[model samples]
Target: MRTLLVSLLSISCLHAIDHGPYIQWFQDPCHEAEIRWVDRSGFQAKEGEWSRGRGGFGYGDNDDQTVLNGMQNKYTIVSIRKKITLAAPANADDELIVEALYDDGFVLYIDGKEVLRKNSTGADAELEAPGGHEAKAWEKFSLGKIASSLKTGSIVAMQGVNDKLDSSDFSLDIRLSIKGKTSTDLITRSDSWEYLVNQIPEKDWRTSTSLPDAVPWKADAQYTLGYRPVGNGEMTWTSANSHLFARTESKVFSVSLKGLKADTRYEFSIRNESTKEISGPHLMQTAPETFRPMHFVIGGDMFHTLPLLDAMNIRCGQEAPLFAALIGDHAYTNNGNPDRWYQWIDSWVTHCRAKDGRLIPMVMGIGNHEVAGGGFFPENNTPTPDKADEFYTLFRMSSEGSRVISRYAVDFGNYLSFILLDSGHTEAISRQVPFLAQSSANRKKTPFLFAAYHRPAWGSGCKDDAVDIQQKWCPIFEKNGVDAVFEHDHHTYKRTWPLTAGKRDDANGIPYLGDGAWGVAVRNPSKAELQKRPWIAKQAPINHLIRVTLAKDGFTCDALTADGKTFDSGTYPLRK
Candidate 1:
């Protein structure tokens, strides 16, 4: 009888694990859709003329009442597009439902096919042409003949809304409420595995043109010893099913958990020993000592914004990454104050999770904003006691015997190696270069190697350069075959074609990937500014988290949006 009961519970767990398909939710016809907008200044706009600006909240129960009044200035016109895909064909009589809040007029198109034009006047002849608009809010439009429209790959529903030329305040907010069947999502961690492994289906994980080998792992081995690495200090760990308190004043501080079966999945929670307050029942996985297949998310510059922060947390849930390589600038409070730092730290630990309620663990790096004396104001070239104390206090550092918790390296068996550097925040670049060089030289033949810092050496037109990094670290990264250097703090997205000495040399060079947009909903870099850096192969002005994976075949990196889709992806071959 007991055996039968156990089998039933196991079946229930397996059934619960399949959230949906292996890829991100392509469409949810029942719920309101997500909108991507591009604003154009003049009436005469070209198809490729609009810049990709980032900042759109998803719609749900309050979607119809959603207000998008971010603009206080009266603008000329706004163009937007929403990509909707269906898993199965819709009925021929199905309709495309949309509600809008516009100042002047609007034009709508599904799959580039013109559906309706309301109040559009003056020079709006072509379907792609912009027109003058009129004031309207909560205007509903149910256009028929959209139920079975299928484009080659994906369907685009475009809308061009115009604002009154003389209006004092301008804003355009719209929602596409479609009724149809849509492709859905399946969480990666499969419960069918007796061992820990990332279960992907049909090699279609990217959901885009890029084919990145999304490696999950099979860690059937055990640590043997009970001691596991958690935070700066070591702690003995059991499984997440039980509570293990840190032997400190705060019983619930972050600590590295060691001594578990390799490639295993576990859920953990933190409890304040004194108050009995609990923080998480969050999920996590262990690193396999061998290169089975693994991926991790990395970025920085959170700046304490809730929406953007939620985006990072949301992506973590979707990707279910092994760990996040956080390269600094989380929470804009740079000034050294205990209360401010504590507030930021509290927020960071509480959020930052995967879509399936997995709490993320960060492999941290120190950015200028991470310290007390560095910011838009003056910067001290040296480290102080309070600068990165909060970070050090909140997380574990595997710095070996060194005192510099700000910089360290973690070895995931022979599979991967990471040189997490301090980038002049806690230690001057000149001082940390020797250690970086030594570490790089030793790991020259590793299958996958990465170096991370807070600032950029070859950024996209902004203060992307860190003189010390350009002269000191760049030489080492280029010479030692560092696959890529993860960087942040510029608040824009960028990827360089293999670079050597600040120039693109694709033949033999290191690609600098970042301009952290994790939680900062800052504006995208102007097109003009983006053109200034000829070395940048790709750039996105959106908040994102970067995922790099060491697959069975090669190495892959993708800039994933908050919605669990790959905005841009690149895969690299391993060195001989």
Candidate 2:
């Protein structure tokens, strides 16, 4: 029987007072409330005048001041009745975040004592004040520590005390969320492995015919680790820094398998030594020298938007793939501000968890939009200065210097390999040519070789016709026997035939998929352009996502549109 899980928010369990009748709630639980004084006569604060606080609340905007008033005999708390429940975690390291909005000054008490205090009343008062108000609201506060204090079924309460002299429309909004341990919650099963191709001697593993640069062998390079539980025993394998070429250096990285029972469920994760952030405890089942049919999802260019996120969630629910490859443009950065990236990841953390409450293992690629001006031109290019900086900081991607630009690859068991490439802001494609060539040669054992980058080699929406792909990257792709290429940019869907240099379709050419319709929109591809390109096989004007299934016969690809239509479908046979 298949298990079904649904995530729901019960507001009554989150707060002590019920303010639902007076204030409107925002979709993002993290945001502060937009209080409108519904009482008509305004709020009467007798205790003291409501003033601003120091840090305000914990919301993103620091300019919003929190309401503050001292306890006085004249003050009567105009109660905004709301109840907040504390999130109890199954594990110890779990974190809970909370945000509240108020007019004037306010204090947070756990069991009737001050845990957090805010008073934005001085010259700094203007800085903490929320935008647009005679009396601004407090900034949203983040209470990771508070989450740690919660007992499973504890009552979390909040009181919005108001001063007597100050009277205006009073209201408050509250949000509570919990994040569990990052790497300790995955399901793993163990199986014994059998070698497929032993033509190359075991001692000569470094000289094998796999793509050379595809595997990084640097001693300092990061690695992914996990344990497979089989009954009463567990098997741990720290992924070897498999080099794409024999000439590449070797690196030492290992995964730990612990406390796992043989043939039992366990979890695994990728740890980046450089950043100390864990990738996942994503689920995987192991079989002894046998194949377990696997499924996964791939798509990119998701700008922060609720409707698109909702659609993606629905699609994932329907497909129920084991993993998702977010091939770049996961978030849009306007003017290359890094704060936007933080917001984007935070948004994902709040919404993108799986039905089982497991964080999906995301294989991320860099998109043009992630860079400074969202393009490849030198004028538009401004590499993020720190390697393992903001963006990479959150998702443990390898970095060269301060820039998160590096060639990386991941093997799905022994059948397929995903080569994630960076194509924005930093160095041109020419710089990574060596790595690309090495990646192609390493695919002999892995029948399926998929590559993804930011911009497309061929697309219809833009009249330029994927100039960058044509000029700089096509040769590299053709030189290496890459199977399919995933590209994002146009905010509309388009797929191309396997073609060689220029545009002639070739039976042996590599197929190109995508023009990134994840969350943004653009003008439809013109009929003239569509007709002009014979290699163009499919197109969709709506937001859509791609699902790829790998099997023994070959591979199947389907494009599912936002409205739940399968706009395109095709099968690519394995190389003979």
Candidate 3:
């Protein structure tokens, strides 16, 4: 079968079909790109010691294929050159397509003439100095019809510049193609995203792989995230929501698609309006207007090793749940590092798709690791939004804005509610009391009201009971009759007997589940520790996620391990 598959692929490559509405000439898919790179100080006009490697050259970020060591604190620029051998070339009507991922900035040259640049400044004849912009996402540029410059064979060169020699990280990657009329659409899972030239001028036309920065109070584009919904033969472009990342000033934005029939599947693609880059033909489903059986997976300590997280994510995807509630410690960026967030988000998008290809919506909460400096603060100083900038920015918590406050509540019609809390990560635990009290009160009639936060109030694996949570929030949870509370941060699996006022109350108390072992290394509470905590009903040392199925009168919880094996299960009646 393997041999037959290889043979079939080879045969398909031999015969090219005219896939046109627009003319396109892509680099040979099988060709290994020959890239040479060297530091600026070591560069010699055309003769210098250069190292041979593929594209993506830099260090400090995980994206690099060729790691440039010692580049930090020594030089701010690296010279990169690639030899391109086109199958055919030299057409005035053909535009040379250029896509680059660069930190600081860079200038692209073909046959020693400057064709494009970004975050860089210098004359055409000399290397451009670095600009101060950190790399956001891949930037796309269409160098219109390079017939006079590009021939059958040309040397492509770039000076990958860094914002500063002392910068923490640097990277540069380049992709080249040729297209007539316009470049090929950025193909995503569900659609072919074509670029429309008239939207922006060719020379000044630059688009990001991610959404552009949010436009302030613009009617059509109000958010940091932007999208153009492609359907039938027309495109409706709109943008909504905005949450700012303090470090890069990049906002996470969204575009809303409203007035959909309940329980119906819809397809849409995400596109950057400015750069004309598009991704997705992703799937989504609306909730039924009437009550129905549904389930959602919840977990925390979400990111550890990539393989472990991916395995668990893939399993969760297999469940085809309506959504996922990642309580906290997501990405474990630890210090709000943008690169780590990039990796984590990419992984989730890639692995968390349901078998039917639906993109699972995420409900998030703040945790200790989400904040820089380990989520601890002096008694008088409460943790603030700026401290957990990445978390607030990457995930929009409310229409008010991610930076407004970490605690918020979301309802699924009138059947279910999720109260996401800060748990001392971004806001004081005591400060959350009033908010929690009111949030729980508003959801008193909700059939399945649940609370999720990072720290545990009745922890099984750790000694500290998160006293503040017990004192300030527990009373509110019990008073308002929250059905259950999800707790994380201890890295162990736990389920507690229903407790109303710090003591188990089988009939009226709120049951607490989870010690947040998601993708992190799991811990086993010693026999002594379990014995000391009488409220504990069950415990395990395993990476698992909780799949909660909500019914009309009750919900069922199943704890599945990393490989999707059900190790524990229980059913709880909805609190009256």
TM-score of 3: 0.63
lDDT of each: 0.53, 0.48, 0.64
Could you give the candidate ranking by lDDT, starting with the highest? 3, 1, 2
**Cα RMSDs, all models:** 23.2, 21.5, 17.4
Worst lDDT 10-window in candidate 2: 35-44
Q: Indicate which candidate wins on TM-score.
A: 3
Query: Residues 233-329, candidate 2, lDDT per residue (tens digit)?
Result: 4535465232111111111122223233322334444444544444444343322122355566777778757577656755654565655677666
What would the per-residue lDDT of candidate 3 be over residues 1-576, giving only the tens digit for each residue? 433432332233112110000000011101111110011111101112333443556666655544455677866667655445555544678767787888878877677677888877763223355456665687778887774365544566666677676888887777777777544422111111111110221232122112222221111222112222224444444544444444532334444445445566655544434434344444555555556998989999977888878788778778888778888887887654655665676556556766666656677777889888875553357776777777765654543343467678766667777888888876778877878888789889988899999889899956467877888889888888898999999998999998988788888988899889888887787788788889998888889999999887899889998677998887888665
Kindly report the root-mean-square deviation of model 2 from the true structure over all alpha carbons.
21.5
Candidate 1, which ten residues in sequence have the lowest lDDT sum? 18-27
For 30-115, candidate 1 gives per-residue lDDT tens digits of: 11111110111111112222222211211111111111233223334454433344556666666667666554555655555566
lDDT comparing candidate 2 with the true structure: 0.48
| Per-model TM values vs. the true structure | 0.54, 0.56, 0.63
